[model samples]
Target: MTLAAPTPTVPLNGDFWHTPLYTRTVDDGPAVNDALHALVLDRTRTAPTSTVGVRNADKTSSDLLRWEHPAIDHLRGWITDAAWALNDHVGAGRTPSGQDAEMIAEAWAVVYRPDGIHQLHSHHDAAWSGVYYVSTGHMQEGTGLLQFVDPRPSAAAREPDRTPLYTIRPEPGLLVAFPAWLRHWVTPYQGDAERVVVAFNVGFSRS
Candidate 1:
């Protein structure tokens, strides 16, 4: 397999210490999405819902991306490289050797039908976790948005709008990764179509 090049990562917040949010938008949106649609649909046939999050949606195990498919392979590689780029960006200098880098990667897929929602949770054992949007679905306001909570228990509370809770609207091909411990959840999806997402995590190889 050819080694995939790393895409430029954008820092959502300048203050890396406060709440680091890294994002990258892949260019191969059409092909990857087409492939993902079939891959997810086929997997759900046998897997059904794994009962992970608090939602009325189709969820698979963390090993869903392990299958041998072009798009799945591309994502697996893309995310691994992205994690390395993030490490280098943070000055950790951890193995940024492209495809040759050592890392523990796991990913799962979720298909949220209308009114599907997931509860708040965090990837407790991962270094960096991300949510990749394959299909944003036809959503209205405040639907299918990824919401992240402030880790600080008490900083400063603002009225009118919840200052502690930040949100990112879903976009196809968008890959947003953040600290593993940042607790987050998705708002109930009220879309007419399916909202497809791939949730992934990466950590140093424990060799």
Candidate 2:
């Protein structure tokens, strides 16, 4: 008796338990950069912090979220817009009445001089986090890339294309947002110009 090979006819279905990352480029680029120079640049000169990071020489401003700086003030509209976008994304898998609550928790500026870097870390005690590139002068490879590592436990077993980490080259007037718990870092800058960014965290709150 000859046995015939079985044919598999059912279509395979798949779902990705994926992470969401958001990016936006400000339309009014010149206005945004002007504000950064007018407000943020001078403050970093005197208030550089010797705080948490790979480099002690890196100039990171104290939490500017609570401050009354004009630049910070100008970010309110953008921050609110970002929060709403996140809320919509988080609420996508839930019932309309069960949507997530989100708000900007805090913000600060980071200035990485040549050879400066921010070590790998995650934003704790928050629901979302983001960065706005105020000035990323002279875009070039290895000039401080913002990177995120895969949070999946299966990362070790994935293929090369599924490599665990990915990076974004900083550009002026760009904004990027992601989950707060995701691990991220900045590569050591090699350019002569400072890589300036405004980083912020978002918290969930009752409406």
Q: Which ten residues in a row have the lowest lDDT in candidate 1?
A: 1-10
Off by over 4 Å in 2: 1-17, 56-62, 92-104, 158-161
Task: Quantify all predictions' global Cα lDDT against the true fold.
Answer: 0.77, 0.66
Candidate 2 lDDT over 115-193, as tens digits, reads 7788999988777788888887675676688898888876676565666777788888878888889999988777757
Over 1-207, each residue of candidate 1 has an lDDT whose tens digit, in order, gives 222335553344334327667777888777988899788878888765676775778788788666888888778766866676666567643455534445577888999888899899999777889988888787888788898987877555534354778888888898888888899999999887888899888876656
Worst 10 residues of 2 by lDDT: 1-10
Model number with the top lDDT = 1
- Give me the displacement of residue 137 in model 1, in angstroms: 1.5
Best by TM-score: 1
List pairs with backbone clashes in candidate 2.
none
Each candidate structure's TM-score, on Cα atoms with residue i matched to residue i, is 0.85, 0.78
Give Cα distance to truth, residue 128, candidate 1, Å.
Answer: 0.3
What candidate 1 gets wrong by more than 4 Å, as runs, is 1-17, 93-101, 157-162
